[model samples]
Target: MSTFEGHVYLDHHYPPVLWNIVRGGFDSVGLLPDGEKDFAISVSLASMLQNSSASRLEAELSLEQVRLATTPNSVSRLRGVFVFDDIESISRIWDSNKWGGHFIDEYLADVGVWAKKSTRVDAAWIDDIINNQGKLLPGWEAAAVKYWSGRPKSKDAPIWEVLVEGRFCIWSMHSKEAALKEISAIWPNSLGLLTHSMNCFGLGSLDGQCFAGITGNEAGISIDHYLRMIDSKEAEFIEQLARLPAESPKFFAGKPDLEKMCLPDLTGYSGRICAKDDTNLTALLNLLSQLKNETGS
Candidate 1:
């Protein structure tokens, strides 16, 4: 097994300057061209940084069992990644090199690198945070104070490590961004859905409400009641799907008419199913479903 634990090296090549700028200093992606690949981040995800640039990398950071990008999409241009690579800080808690994003960070924050909140608090680690206050984010003074004080600290501590290690606590994700671009390139109106675990190209309502997303301790979501252990942004995505079924049963609970949903005969598809990826199949299904819903196809 490789000695490096949390690092993920990509196949792309670039000059070594990428890592030099961000190493122990900057967090901006100055080297890469400023494109959609550089921005569009959510506070909900863990960040990524390049440790070296001879090759490329993005990482999946998690302190809990809920997987994030367990197997990231292939890379070229990437985005929303954090820039910091002090590997020793996360070496103890990082799991799976299957690399990249937020679900991982959320898990880490809630559960922790050593274990969940409060259970694994090492008296020594608390002292480290107290003594190394310079490494901490001044904005989180209350949180650090709580850790040292015999008072209740914030439930999230991953930010503490990230801020200390990178001088900034945010996530950068390339594979998921690329995947979203790929999906939106074809269907501009569709809302992208990413799960905390058991991730896939899940379906969402036409209005951008997701049928699934991260819900800590579980991935499946329902409007009636669901766990919020995963995402800090859950309120924004409450499933209207469940509530609609009760008020507008015809649209929500009723089955679609197969006759009205039949696809128009089109030219044969030209793609193959890879042993590793079946998203092509999923996309094809989506395309056919979309065609069936067209008014005059």
Candidate 2:
């Protein structure tokens, strides 16, 4: 067995920089650029950075687990593999139901408000119709119809076969911008300044709303496996796909196989994008903080 020793963020947000690196595709061929691979993300999901002390505690425990399982020589060779590797921050109480309803409703309202403000539409009409309407009251299609018609005409305006798709796509474009802005506010020097594509493509809805997933790279290979792959020229990345066990519905909740690539939940061990420097990690952390403060989560 191989031993791994290195620093990893026990709690860190998967920011947009890594998102742009991995390919993403959508139902509409044009939604994502050519030759992109789709990765599913959880729309109702929210990421928050653990407190420094809490993060340190988890890191220490994880390191101890690595030390106990592998040999010293193996550990030495594998140290570099953990550097800047994406770490899985396990949630002690992983309950999606708690935030699912509120996040979906608030997200829709926020998107409606953004459309009205950005398009220079009648602010009162938007506020009166889209923003104020409860999730079930006016309904998503009703709101989308009002918002789409209310806004000024443009060739850029999107047309969707299903009204829900329109709500999802339109919200995804704008919400991603909002998310990037939030990240930029926290980390001014972030490399992922530009928004790229939507994650969680094929997955339909999340908690009665569209599943606009988070963007990040996948830990397809575990740290130990990554070390082995790097050491062996024969280890083809394609062959590694066979190592993944069959469908794990408990974690994925009926999401397709592609979602496994998008979210690193299946990879037993954790890693990080920046081990030595955590500036980029703070961008998502700060965004989570602001969100929790506002939402009371």
Candidate 3:
């Protein structure tokens, strides 16, 4: 029921196939996740809680490629990555404001306007689309229907609404700041600069995981530093959840962690791999996946 407008980052590792996925077109509605219903619902709920009119509920996803090495001096090869959203700006807006319901209502008044701009239809047509009873309305009608129906009836609603409501979590952003701030707080003596690629933003929820990744970034730190910060953030999120009421849907199983979240790094092994063949992306990918699995990443 509450609005959490934070940035989310999604990290996908592999060969440079992200470009293929983007060119293939990332459709939100048709490709429902197999086991992430809760995350999908959280996003649907978050959409209703947005401060702005989002008539185009479909998500925009893109990918970026980065280099990975096992060590600082080792040669590095390409890995697919993306910076899905810069949540710092939006997070400030939703977190600072107390107008949860008030803002949503205000934005609803413009949902028609948003639809008009996106679909290039007039107010009359927009109304017709919303009021339409047919199985299919027209161009973009299905998207409009999903958006309109998903609007939160009150500040709170049942969790099952996600099934009937539509998938809106595709519009979330997982902020890198979640890690940055927590790391700073936990390890005040640790000095490092962390940044993201800011190239892509996407949302997905599978197996209790709901996240928006604004992909890209090498966490310019050692493996120990990266894991330490990740562990700290997990603790912080767990603590925050415990303080909240049990009935609140805002608290979900997925809290950004090493398994679901990835920070770009050059490991010592990767550095050695680079030495074998700087251009061998396959070798680089194999090692990266191996490291990820071994570390439970």
Candidate 4:
């Protein structure tokens, strides 16, 4: 086994560079432009000076002599850097007609290199209705339902929900009131629903809310309850379908695959079958029946 060592640093304002070379150093590799190979190698004494931590911003003053002697060009532009070489000098040996196969096998065994870091701004875009709150546009509720079903136009709708799960914290830019309201409705119960917002961007400013939640211990229960609530609502819709003529029920087409659906088995390792075995069509029917009996439908 072989070992390699290196460090990475990141900042906003400049390009990346790498450095440091002892005489007879290891070959350094990096990403190549539009190449079929994952990476390429560059062996230059100047590359070392450009990437060295000793040559960082305002600090290069001390290394000016070394930089001038090594590269003959200003070293201020390169921001990213990586350096690696085999401990066995396998490349050198291979070059001397001592080996048959590539030295990459030995190189892979020794060195492990990683890329440097970079930064950028993140943002989201929200539509007019969600921007104005649920009340901004008339007939928004119907449009929301349609949007929820993936048929949206003109009016705005809530595209994502931000929940606080476990100990996760979120910093909201605006819409704290709406975010708090949604949190109050979901927290201490179902937090997994919040994972969808963790890396969200494009959720527009204003009319949109962002908040953080702490995932509570009862997260599983909360999630189950939330899903059941959705299932119950779907059950109500199915009940309505059962009452309608078969020809009129086409509106429910292409909705959720309730027939093959399976609910979580709260007690066992295997998921519970939502419908009966063999004939998967009865799960929705049984759920509708249960809902109707409870609701006096």
Q: Rank the candidates by TM-score, best first.
A: 2, 1, 3, 4
- Show the lowest summed lDDT stretch of 10 residues, model 3: 110-119
lDDT of 3 by residue, 90-136 (tens): 34335545423323311211000000001111112223342223222
Score each candidate by Cα lDDT.
Answer: 0.23, 0.24, 0.23, 0.23
- Winner on lDDT between 1 and 4 is 1
lDDT for each residue of candidate 4 in 102-168, tens digit (9 for 90 to 100)? 2233222212232222111000111322322212344434433342232324233222211100111
Candidate 3 total steric clashes: 32
List runs of model 3 lying over 4 Å from the truth. Answer: 1-32, 44-175, 183-297
Quick one: best TM-score, which candidate?
2
Error of 4 at 225 (Å): 8.8
Ten-residue region with minimum lDDT total, candidate 4:
15-24
Candidate 4 residues lying further than 4 Å off, grouped into runs, are 1-215, 218-226, 230-238, 244-247, 254-261, 264-297
Provide the TM-score for each candidate, comma-separated: 0.19, 0.20, 0.18, 0.14
lDDT for each residue of candidate 1 in 1-297, tens digit (9 for 90 to 100): 011112222111111111111111111121112231122211222112212211111111111101112212111112122222334435433443222433244223111111101111212233333222123233434343343333323343231222111112112344334334443343233221212111110112212111111111133211111111223235543444335456554334233233332221111211111222234223323332332332221
